[model samples]
Target: MNTLMVMGYGNSIAMSQILVVVVEILLLVKIGEPLECKRKEIVTNTPVISSNCYRECEYPSKPTVCEYEFNVVLHQTMSAHCGDCPFKKEDCNLEKCVPVDGSSRPLIAVNGSLPGPSIVVCEGDTIRVKVTNNLQSGAGVTMHWHGIHQTNTNWMDGVPRATQCAVARGSSFVYEFIAEPAGTHWWHSHAGYQRASGAFGPLIVRKSRKTEFNSNTYDFDLPEHTMTLTDWADMTSLDIALKVNIPALNPRSQTVTILMNGKGERIEFFDETGQIFKTPRQMFEVEAGKKYKIRLIGAFIAACMTSFHIEKHSMTIISTEGGEIIPYETDYLTIAQGERYDFVLHANAVPSAYCIYASGYGNSSCPSNATFILKYKSSPLNNPTCASYAVVPASQDRDQYMGNRSKGMFSAIDFVSSDPGDQELYRVDLRHYITLRSYAIYKHPKDPGYLNGFLAVDNVIYTPPLLPFVTNEPDDSDICQSTLNKTFYYTCGMKQCVCTNILKIKLGKVVEIVFLNTDEDIIQHPMHMHGGSFRLLGLGSFHTKKMTLDNVIQLDKEGGLLRNSPVKAALKDTVMVPSNGYAILRMKAENPGYWFFHCHTMNHGERGMVIVLQFGEPSEMPKPPLDFPRCEGWEPK
Candidate 1:
């Protein structure tokens, strides 16, 4: 068998492959015989240490008192199968799966549940989070608090290997920081492909008292219901990675059917048999003439641009990504993966149920899904049935209703722009090109590329690179060593080529990203970033000048450019880049820590369309404790 080893600095070098094999042998001897002996062998040979030693042992101690105090925790658990399964009964056994912590289970989870937990707080509040690792085996775990501004607290930003070592099995760590510039955000696991398993939750920060009142509102009521949409894959995260990146194991295409918190099996509604079965897909109800804000979070792995319509009533977008925006009325609003949109709908027409549907953007062939009825009561209007009503498309024209006088009325308060004097634009310190490649089941000469017809970035098919930045945290020596081997190379010279460039941004800097889609693949990619949102500056094919500002602009379609001509304005987080096209985006690096930038499409991210953004100065960042037990033999040379 192939052996994997880790060599320590000098004294007491222990090989990981040998240790694992020895432990496995011991386990085999005690299996079905003596339970105590098996337990002893496992504990003595394969000990589980407090992986959080670095976090707990850090020096200079955390501040005794801070601006705010928040408490949160992270726990690990097992799931039998993927949450997005139509058959719901196919639980991927946690016991037989590999990868130690049972993380290889078809649906192992962080915090013991799907959609994790909701973290709600006001702006400026100091928060403290305590994460507890509870899986059977050691599993690397990290958390990126989507858009919160915790400058210089990069180490505390949970990212396995990059920010610090993985939280050891049955260990805990405290993440403390202050929340700034409130907005709708999320948190997810940074470990290898774990986020796909279901390790994410909502991070909503309420607006400050001043900002809340200034927007001309009285009582601010939360949504009657909050819906998080996500796509589930049936295979284990590791298996998915192997199938996508490995050159000899080509797999079939996967599809998702269940929609959480929508008209799906998750909801328990009464059926004709008087038994509670899964609720059927339906429309949502809202009161006519009354204002209601719907918080839509696209937790799916793909990019989705949702459209809402209620016959004649128009919709107003009040907030996005948790930040307040100038209230503007429109027919439809687009949201992408890891993106959130909070819009207020004024139920002015006849009281009835409105159809709220989310359509998949890009080259998605998946059919759109619908939600339950939005009942508009408190009026003498009759409820319209589905047969008599027709669903209207979200209006794109902003000038039709408000007229030319309100053209730039709310432009000033729309989005936060960096001040020229305080603008800190840093040069692109680290540039890494990314690509996507597929591998077929066996090494066949006639196979188009790695996987049947898969392409590659540069010369090699893409594989997720080890996140060295977060992994080699605290220790300058190890960090420097990893950085020295930064430039990556792979082998993919057979078929098409599709690569992406990743830039490391400094905290508190304005970054301009230019994307050149070299027409390697025919499908478009919806590129998304965490933390701050970017404005679409320009977009066009390789032949012409860039087009106008659009959140989602289709790349070189067979029929001219697919532009949202009506809503030519800045968007919150998601944007689609056409195939073989070019696009540019401008954003501010307000939040510190390691953030993820990746393609919204699940298949693409799995095939290496993802990168990391390490914000903030290295000097100001905190270091892990000195007493932290190093990985068995992972010391610097």
Candidate 2:
């Protein structure tokens, strides 16, 4: 009487005799009859190797998706110390890398190249790079497009924990974004410290030559002339980071060698065997009497301030960070990390090979130097006798470039922006002053042995959130708003203030961000802001012995602040804030999304020198894709 009905595909059983009926139904399905069901098949698109690798980018009449496949994996240099490079065997393995740096250290390569593959496209073209993390070591990776304005496609920015999660091992991620504001740019790893292990390359966004700002100044702009400057070491970035974080290790982790376009002679600093081998150098070919437009990218991971100069030639800088500037000639260029310069080199010297020199400049820098040959097309293949390292500049003073020692030296203030926006940043709606400093921060309040060096902005170490802010609205308990309750910069000094530093800016509001490098021990920091370029208002040291935010504010109110050319200030995304000095930047918060603002120096940035800039409201931001990879904090469940 207490019967229950159980439903099957085409039969029902009463609970009174359920056990007997279930056994009968199981026998019927397994032996007596076949169950009818519809099976589904799933198909996944196979990644294809595009044959357009390294081909010249065309300026398309209409925008199109420039898809690229990036297979990131652990690779090694060819043979021993790249001695067997330049192989021409038809059956030779293309996956083997040849850095030509005379070191067979392990590297993380993209598409089987040291500097990876260059992404050259026209402005407004959509770039879709499907990155497959092929590393068998169970590592994750992400690529950041340096100097790219993500605009409505903020998720494609490639900053893990800020924009999106890392592409996990054996997984793939498709980064799709529209390229705009054509200029010399680059792409590199934003995860796993893999960029220093040779995971970066040039990214040139081209527009019509006729529409270029300083087009008439140069006669030719070739793809081969684009050079990437980087610092290399025999050890991996993780080893260097370990030595740096734990200072008691007596860190000899400075630049062992510098590379130009992934070519350099090996330096045996860490090589205990002291084995040296001859390695080939990069050669830039030029025709006689032709003015060549050379695009230089400073992609260094170290804190080395590199100065580049070509012997018997002068460089006329026309543009910086993709913005056209008033042309100025200089004997050499002192470039920091994450900076780009487009200069015109007039091949006026006699038809012969000349040494292009690059040497480290400033204090706290090692004697890291590199050389490349600039040879005329018809010249013989001979090494120049004068192809030696140039003497490093003795003057460590950066601000002295404006005074008596300014000849043949040009900084950002020396050149003015030729074409600025219609709305000048004469005044701003909000102002935020941050002091760039490095000091010891103990992890625990009562523990002194747990102290580690941390680079901070306004005494707050920027720790990235586990869940990306772009997709998830993290609770206030997750982020550390140190400045909300603080008034002065030195209040939290030596107190270990670490958190996800967030700076919110309203839409269309012009904001002024002043960087104060009042800390005497700290050197120059190349501060790079994401999303868009800004107006470089000023850069100079304070007159007082001890300067603070309040002091700078009073100086600004009294018109005592040293400023650049107000009308022709340079437009830049990265500005070098001098040591014991200051830098002023102004821009309108138009891009409505979360962006990164941090020191481009990888060592400093990794040790908490960063800030998250949230522009506009959540409603104004573009929504991410439905199937986009989502990440969150995972507690011990």
Each candidate's clash count: 49, 0
lDDT by residue (85-162, candidate 2, tens digit) is 433322122445465466667788887777888887777767778788998778889999998999898888999988
Per-residue accuracy of model 1 over 216-270 as CA lDDT, tens digit each: 4323345334556665444555665555555344565644433443223233435
Model 1 has a clash total of 49
Off by over 4 Å in 1: 1-113, 136-139, 217-219, 223-225, 233-255, 258-277, 280-287, 303-313, 364-367, 377-510, 530-533, 539-574, 588-595, 613-617, 620-637
Score each candidate by Cα lDDT: 0.47, 0.76
Model 2 RMSD, rounded to 1 decimal: 11.8
Cα TM-score of candidate 2: 0.85
lDDT for model 2 comes to 0.76
- Largest lDDT belongs to which candidate? 2
Alpha-carbon shift of residue 147 in model 1 (angstroms): 2.1
